[model samples]
Target: MRWTVHGERTILDTPWVRLRSLDVEQPDGARVAYDVVRLRDLAVATAVDDQQRVLMMWRHRFVTDTWAWELPMGLVEDGESPEAAGARELEEETGYRPEVMRELIYAEPAAGITDSRHFVFRAEGARRVGEPSERNESDRLEWIPLADLPGMIARREIVSSATLVGVMALLLDLRA
Candidate 1:
């Protein structure tokens, strides 16, 4: 069963987010206006080192009023590939350049109401290039041992859905 989308009306449009009301008919024959959030595709870089540590930042999200660890990530600009965007964010936010990068996973954190896409990439190892060009990104940067992920997650220290999904996929890859 699939829902029928009759039409959509833009409620608010912005460079970062778009709000829209969709006229949809459910499989059960009920029609209603459903609100959806549209966001730019996000590119996330999970850089790891030879020491088996993953690069991360401790940052505060004002919207949630919470602090957590997150990977270097940003919106994918128009005409840029997800990989390229991930690389740019990694360098800008962390001052590290990946020697090699590859796709790890893709996730839609809130697909039920948002068309946002998350492109997660794994950077095998990185080398420090210079100071981060994008300031105020985070409070501290660290190469966190992968072994600490479970504990960090258990303590609610890593809360971003993108980071959670990416790390879980990485952990699964390790088992494979």
Candidate 2:
């Protein structure tokens, strides 16, 4: 069963996010207004080297006041493909350029509240170039061993949704 959207009014509009009030009739015959946050699509990458180490960043999210390890990611700009954006973000955030990028998985984190799509890619290898193009994005960048992923996750050190999904998918793909 699907809900029928009768109308939608913008509550807030910005380059990064758009908030809307949607008037809809549910399949259960209830009509209501729902607030939704719409976000631009994101491109995320998991870059792994030949030594079985995955490139990661240790960062803090002020909103949650938490520090965790995450993959390189950014919003997909207009006119830029997800793969291109992923490659750009990987380099800009970590100074590592992907040698091979393949789609790992896509995730919608909060479908009920936000229409945010994350395009996750896996890079079989990467090479470090110059310094990172952008600073203050992370406290440290490290090439973590693949065998340590489960421990990191268990320790709550790898907490970003996109990173978790991408890494798990890549692991599964590797097994296949």
Candidate 3:
């Protein structure tokens, strides 16, 4: 069964977020106003090296007030493709440019309330061209061994939805 969306009214509209109330009709014949959050799509890069390690950054998320490891990522700009945005963000945030990138996963983490999509790509390899241009993106950059991912995740160090999905998929792939 699928819910029918009669219409939607915006409660707030901004560059970063859009909030709306949707008039929906349930399959069982109940009508309700459902609140939703719309956010800019994100592009994420999971860059791995020859040694089975992935490039990551330690950063503080002001919203959650927590520091954790994450893949280089950013919002996809209006005129750029997700791949291009991922490559640009990788260099800007980590000073690494991927030689080649391929789509890894797509996730709508909070689909229950938010329509934000995360596009994750795997970088075949990357080279450091210079220091990170985005000064406040992260506190430090490191190449973490993939073998340690389970422990890190267990410790709650890798917490971002996109990062978790991408790395978990990678881990799952290794089993096949």
Candidate 4:
């Protein structure tokens, strides 16, 4: 099933996000209008050390007004590759640099009303080189054991969708 776009109009355009109004023909031959959110694609990195621990950050998101464990992530800047963005975010968020980085998975966190792609990466051989860059993004960073993820998620400790998907992808890769 496919929908044909009749026309589209931009309602709001900002540097960080854009909202568009789409007029389309639905798959059932119905005409509809949808408010679509256009956001920059982001990349999240699951950095694992020699002991198989996953690096996580405890950050408070103002929009959600909640603190949760999240993997190092950031928006994919214009003209930058996902891999590069992942590496840059890993360093910027945790002050750790990975020697090896590989794509683990790609997902759309919300597909119905938004167009944002998240690229997850597996980074190995990471080492802390200096203090964190003092960015206003995170409060604390820690390396947690992979096996403890399920309990953390259950307790609402790890709520970031990209982080969850990234860890699950790594787990699936190992099981395969």
Candidate 5:
């Protein structure tokens, strides 16, 4: 059984997000309203080097009040393709350029109440160009060994949803 959305009303709209109140009807003939958050799609880059290391950013999320390692990512701006945004964010945040990039995974972090999508790209043969264009994006940037990821996740040090998904997908592909 599927829920039918009869209509929607905008509760809040802004450049960053849109909150909608949906008028929906269930298969059981029950009608109700649901609120959903809509956000611009995010592009995430997982860059791996020749030495089996991944370029990552050590950053603090104010909302979560936690510091963790994360893949370089950002919202896809208007008219920007997710691949282009992934490559752009990789360089902007980590000062590394992807010699090759391909889509690795696509995910939605919170499906129950949000329409946010994440496009994760696998980048190989990354080279450092210079300092990051956006220094404020992270406290420190480092190349962490891919083998160390399982321990980091177990320690709760790599906690970003997109980062976790992207890294695990790449790891699984590597293992296979």
Candidate 6:
């Protein structure tokens, strides 16, 4: 069952997101308008140290009003490659620069609602150079044992989808 596209219009466009309205014929042959969100691609880094611990940050998200532990991640800026963006975001968010970064996984967190792709990378052997770029984003940074992931997720401590997926990928890699 394919919807026939009648027309489409850009409702709003911005650096972060673009909103579009599309007119299409439904399965019942009725015409309707649907809204779509176009977002920039994001990069997430799962930085693991020599001790085989995953680097994580504890921060408060204003929109969700919850404090959660998450991996370092950010949007891939224009003209930047996913690998570069992952390294940049890792350094910026955690103040640790990875010596080796490899793409681990790529996923669409919400394919139904948004057009945003998240690239997850495995960063091995990172070194803390200095303090985080700022203190507002994260109040504490720590290396958590991978074995503790299940408990954390069950407790709702790790809520970010990118972070969860990245950690699961890391765990799978370890098992393999």
* Per-model CA lDDT versus the true structure: 0.93, 0.91, 0.93, 0.89, 0.92, 0.89
User: Candidate 3's residue-wise lDDT over 11-118, tens digit each?
Assistant: 999999999999999999999999999999999999989899999999999999999999999999999999999999999999999999888888999999999999
Q: What clash pairs does model 4 have?
A: none
Deviation in Å, model 6, residue 148 alpha carbon: 0.6
- After TM-score superposition, what is the CA distance of residue 60 in candidate 1 from its true location, in Å? 0.9
Q: Evaluate model 2: give its lDDT.
A: 0.91
Give per-model TM-scores: 0.97, 0.96, 0.96, 0.95, 0.97, 0.91
For residues 1-176, could you state the per-residue lDDT of candidate 4 as single tens digits? 99898888999999899999999899999999989999999999899877878999998988999989999999999999999999889998889998988999999989988999999999878888877785887878888998898899899898889988988897787677
Q: Residue by residue across 55-99, what tens digits does model 5's lDDT show?
A: 889898888788999999999999999999999999999889988
The per-residue C-alpha lDDT of model 3 at residue 122 equals: 88
What is the Cα-based lDDT of residue 129 in candidate 5? Answer: 95
Q: Can you give the lDDT of residue 21 in candidate 2?
A: 99
Task: Name the better of 3 and 5 by TM-score.
Answer: 5
Give me the candidate number with maximum lDDT.
1
lDDT of prediction 3: 0.93
Please give the TM-score that candidate 3 achieves against the real structure: 0.96
Which one wins by TM-score: 2 or 3? 2
Worst 10 residues of 5 by lDDT: 123-132
For every candidate, C-alpha RMSD to the true structure in Å: 1.0, 1.0, 1.1, 1.2, 1.0, 1.7
Model 3, 76: alpha-carbon shift in Å? 0.9
Q: In candidate 3, where is summed lDDT lowest over 10 consecutive residues?
A: 167-176
